[model samples]
Target: MELRKSGSAVWSPASDWRRGSTVRWLLLSVGLGWISLFDSTLWSQTKEVVLPRGTDVSVMKKDILLFEKILDVKLSHIPNAMLAVVDRTKGVYLKGYGIVLTFLVNINRVVITTPFGERPVGKRQTAEEKRRRIHEIREMLIQALKDNPGSFKQLTPSDAVVIVAHFEDSNELDDAKRHKTIVLKVFKRDLDVYKTNGYEKFKQQVVIDEY
Candidate 1:
């Protein structure tokens, strides 16, 4: 059996929150839009757009690059072709209501091999090791977002910055417990508290929906 290092779970938003939301969150569903992040005339097409006033397009580009680099470090240890795209990094804000930032990552591995194209000879990996690896990756993602909190300040207590890490699942597990993907999400109201509270604190408030 092959082993991977991504935590498995889904995020659940409150019923009232969804019903009361004014912004159209297109990226919440599986089959959603993949709008590229850039300065374009597209923003002018709609009165409601992702980038708000004072949003620096250049800084956002750097943030995307930083996200890619962070993912590379985690997957590079074992030669792997991993993809992390910011296809749907959108935001919506309401003056009195709140703001929301949605980020999606596609962690689909193309090839697994060394820089020299040689598979490393190692012993079988255990479940514990895999969980630990996944946890590290999750933390890196959260930290990266925290570091480059561009318009994240606009988010209020009701607002949130959502990050969804989707891992492509190969049908290698037992038929009784097979999954097509592994999703790990980070949902927090206050970014400042993340540093002092730690992962365990955040996990306490996490609402997970497992299949």
Candidate 2:
């Protein structure tokens, strides 16, 4: 009796014809298109800049001024502990980004309002807890200076001073990175101070507190 030939014996089409290759190409194209359409917008609105240890205070002041001029805003009430931007053009200040500060004089502790994202110094039992923390930090700094009047001098003559910069970029974009890219070009002179004093010394002083 004649039996049907095994299906395996039947001729098959080319491997390429069995499945569509365009599926892979289509997926790749769609992925690339999605990536191209992705928005690079910043996630946060206000950016905080705790200046690096090696920044020269004098130069930093100038940089702040220049930044203000470019942005057309006047920042007042600058403090070592915190600074909140108050736009000269507009009267009201935004609370989320503004800093509350209590300036100390003559080694006495002064309490200031604490802004969000600030680390507390001690047990933060209440809303006032944050204010006390800032006051404590200031008090500690005052005490440190009192304990060693020469502490300020411990900073090598060339050691850089720190500065904080605030930008209106609410999205807290990498404005500092972008700003540094341009500022460094114009303020190349400060770069020499770093090379001479060395960032290692500055970093050590910041950590060790040994002047």
Candidate 3:
């Protein structure tokens, strides 16, 4: 994956996900009327394309990479997160999202980082505290299961369609070793239920027929 200073560079997923890319792209298409002020009428000739909804979907798979330079650690391990992209026909645009997570421990503390639009916990936390936080996160997953089985909750925007991913840590020693466990769960959308609840609870109804 390409890495650059935050604002100077934007992330874009590789053309294909099989080779392992963590980048994603967010595009904004402008209107023809506003093009003149920027410099040129770039989009003046743009035309919208319409396709049947739910007709576009592609599967993505990738392995995680550990960035030594970024973390400043002797050793680093990366955990993989599932990636998927769905094409919506209503808009004349395409968007991408990717998720990743990692666990590390240094002399002062243990840290767990998730890129699923969820923020990592700050502050120096004891190894035990970190484990507890993971437990709580697991509970939230359980609650989501209880709320709706066979249905995916968009834990983050990066995770398109249903969500699929797993995390594992094996650190038994007190020195640089803090976690030893594995947790994984994948879920797909329950179109039937989503269509049902979308209207009542979410206040926005998904037109199944559109897809």
Candidate 4:
């Protein structure tokens, strides 16, 4: 008896299995998208603490006035400053991005005469001097971080920390990136991308602009 050739095998089972897997994957992707949207909305609802410019009204005005007087120049002459906060459960540590004015003081000059001795101090620094001093202070700030490891700790996932990095000029951004470990290592809560505004805008809001 002649046996008829077997008809071509039907791969229906394999095709159906693949189709089922594709459907499941699509559903999973949609579910993840919804979850991501919800998370984004929740994050937006949380309060944000802007820095430097966000200080108390009275304190901001006072600082502007003080800087103007000490610099002996218009607020426009002063470079913009940034502020960052290292948030911990106990308290927050704040640092300003501007130069350390204390180091600019003249140690050689005599400021006051006392019965016991004389107090030597320096006069207010010029804009040029302040600019130069910023680089020096940056090194010291980095060194301090290296020396004091306990001062900075890793941030928890829930922690909301803001790091404000002030650049002396636009070119400094590259330098800051080169030495990010010193300048931005403590900012573990977020990535190194900074949201910044112009010094002119900041001056308009806070500076008196008048002599």
**Backbone clash count for every predicted candidate, in the order shown:** 0, 3, 1, 1
Q: Give the alpha carbon lDDT tens digit for every residue of 147-176 in model 4.
A: 332222332322222222232221223554
Q: Report lDDT per candidate.
A: 0.45, 0.31, 0.31, 0.35
**Which order, best to worst by TM-score?**
1, 3, 4, 2
Q: Name the 10 consecutive residues with the lowest summed lDDT in model 2.
A: 178-187
Find the number of clashing residue pairs for candidate 2.
3
Q: What's each prediction's TM-score?
A: 0.39, 0.18, 0.23, 0.23
The ten-residue window of minimal lDDT in model 1 covers: 78-87
lDDT of 1 at 95: 47
Distance from true position, residue 97, model 1, in Å? 13
Model 1, span 1-211: residue lDDT tens: 2234346733345544675563445534322433333334466566565664554446545544555555455445432333333234444443444333334332333334677894433333455644554465566555555554443543444444454444332323564432222333333365546645656665544433323
On TM-score, the candidate that comes out on top is 1
Stretches > 4 Å off in candidate 3:
1-55, 58-124, 144-176, 179-181, 186-211
What's the lDDT for residue 196 in model 4?
Answer: 33
| lDDT for each residue of candidate 3 in 98-143, tens digit (9 for 90 to 100) | 2222332232222444676544333454667646654544444333
Number of the predicted model whose lDDT against the real structure is largest: 1
Which residue pairs clash in candidate 4? 106-122
Per lDDT, what order, best first?
1, 4, 2, 3
Model 2 misplacement above 4 A: 1-18, 39-56, 59-211
**What is the total number of backbone clashes in candidate 3?**
1
